[model samples]
Target: MKHYYGVKVANKIARVMVSSPERSGGQNQYIETPTIEKPSDERSAKLVDLILENITDTYTLESVAEYCMMSVRSFSRNFKSSNAISFNAWLINVRLNYSLELLESTSLTVSEISERAGFHSEQIYRKHFIKKYDIPPKAWQKIFKSPNHN
Candidate 1:
């Protein structure tokens, strides 16, 4: 059986766990992440909103840059600087979040959600979904029901 110790940080509970380590530290080391801070920009924020609103539509970085009235290079740099992620990554995250919301609020199948979430195929959705959530979409749905109340 696996054992866990709980720790509190910023009023949030987190579990310190021991498991089969993926690397040489043997499950003892805490994961490290770099802090890359980027101040938000209005143009990038507007572009993100547009992307989320039209997730089912096909739009490229160039198009989004045009929408923001800037050249693609400048838009890309500002987007990365403001969001710490690329435009495509932000689009994927928006689509994934939409899929997750549908899964939790509607009785949509994985394929239907994939279609509506702008994923080209169920396989693609499953791949990114697992990467983001650490579980298959169906497995997540099975473990949690669609909420019955608003």
Candidate 2:
């Protein structure tokens, strides 16, 4: 019965080929998992470009709605419907992208980069950066900007 169940399970799943017969000897390679990115509609895509163009500018949900010439409630509803992310989340994503560029291209400290990228504080920026990138900003800078990197 044990051997029957093992055969049933083995036939039901994909197998990895390894040179060694030992089960533990198979090398595990890092594979990038697929991400389901939301496909923004035309209006939301344009708004993303506009927000990035003025990335350094301070923004509030109310102000963004006003800029879009829509009522705050309607703006929130429509933006989320089209973009599949809340306004605040998308805003943070934009800020993170700007900070990444700064980290790679400039010698600025993390605090300065956070402030220039419109994050509320360095700690918060690092928290979000780690959550999004699975690494700290300085470490990312070291890996990406180092001349000694192979």
Candidate 3:
């Protein structure tokens, strides 16, 4: 005999199965595994670290290449090859991620967070945030903020 059961908790369902006689080779075949890629090399890893450290600063491809002690052309080529994304895209992602953390952790307004995130203007920050998250930063903050407010 076999039995299957499902329980709902916190608006999500948890499923379980039980059998009088256990079957061999009954693995979770439906589970999905994610593939995580490592940094291609030391240079790419260092670049990522530096960017994260100075995520609030403005940067250009040429300036960043100079800081890395490489020619602009070589830096752009290797950055894309090693990171699997363009430099600008990586920088924007880093800034956005930092902004998200600030929004969730602090009570700062959206405009203040935008300035601290290295965006040139709040409008630009709002546009990018909406594009990436499909919701405004204010709304996102409301959803993620703690529930202890009066």
Candidate 4:
């Protein structure tokens, strides 16, 4: 039923969507961002938006650092200080959460959802999913998608 990225659900959930135009496919990346009381500062807030905006692209710390007009060390320190999470970890969480929503809400194939969630491949996505949730995505989807789930 959601036509676009950044769909908000009831109970205060929201998504922040950013398009990655540099990539050829240029899929929108979404972060199921929770409400934030405040950011550390203006620059930090700006950086978070920038990073989340480009979430689906292949970005190295050095590349993101240069793109942001910052040195690698500065970007790392500032990003860590503000978000309290490393960029890679946050990105993975975002992609996984997005994939979960897709699984529960759509009839998309596992591979399709995995790629849409910006994973390199289904195998890699499965690995991460199993590691994080202790179950494969398909099984998780089955349980949640079933009518009897409670």
Candidate 2 stretches greater than 4 Å from native: 1-47, 146-150
What is candidate 3's lDDT per residue for 1-150, written digit by digit as tens? 332111111112212332222123643211111112446666666766777677677899988888778999999998888767788987776677678767766789999999998998999999988876677989877765534322
Taking the tens digit of each residue's C-alpha lDDT, what string does model 1 give over 1-150? 332221111113212353321235333221111122333676666766666667888878889889889999998888877776788887787787677667665688999999999999999999998886687988765544433613
RMSD, one per candidate, in order: 7.8, 13.2, 11.4, 10.5
Worst 10 residues of 2 by lDDT: 1-10
- Per-residue C-alpha lDDT of model 2 across residues 1-150, encoded as one tens digit per residue: 111122112323323332222133434311111122444555556666677677777778888887777888998998888666789888887687678667766788999999998887899999998887788989866655523222
- Please write out the lDDT profile of model 4 over residues 46-143, one tens digit for every residue: 65576556656676788767766789898888777877777677668767877877776778899999988888889999998887668788986775
Error of 4 at 109 (Å): 1.1
Clashes of 4: 0
Report clash pairs, candidate 1: none
After superposing candidate 3 on the true structure, give the runs of residues whose Cα lies further than 4 Å from its correct spot.
1-40, 147-150
Q: Is candidate 1 or candidate 4 better by TM-score?
A: 1
Clashing residue pairs, backbone N/CA/C < 3 A, model 4: none
Q: How well does each candidate superpose onto the true structure, as a TM-score?
A: 0.68, 0.64, 0.69, 0.66
State each model's CA lDDT, in order. Answer: 0.66, 0.66, 0.66, 0.65
RMSD of 1: 7.8
Candidate 3 lands at a TM-score of 0.69
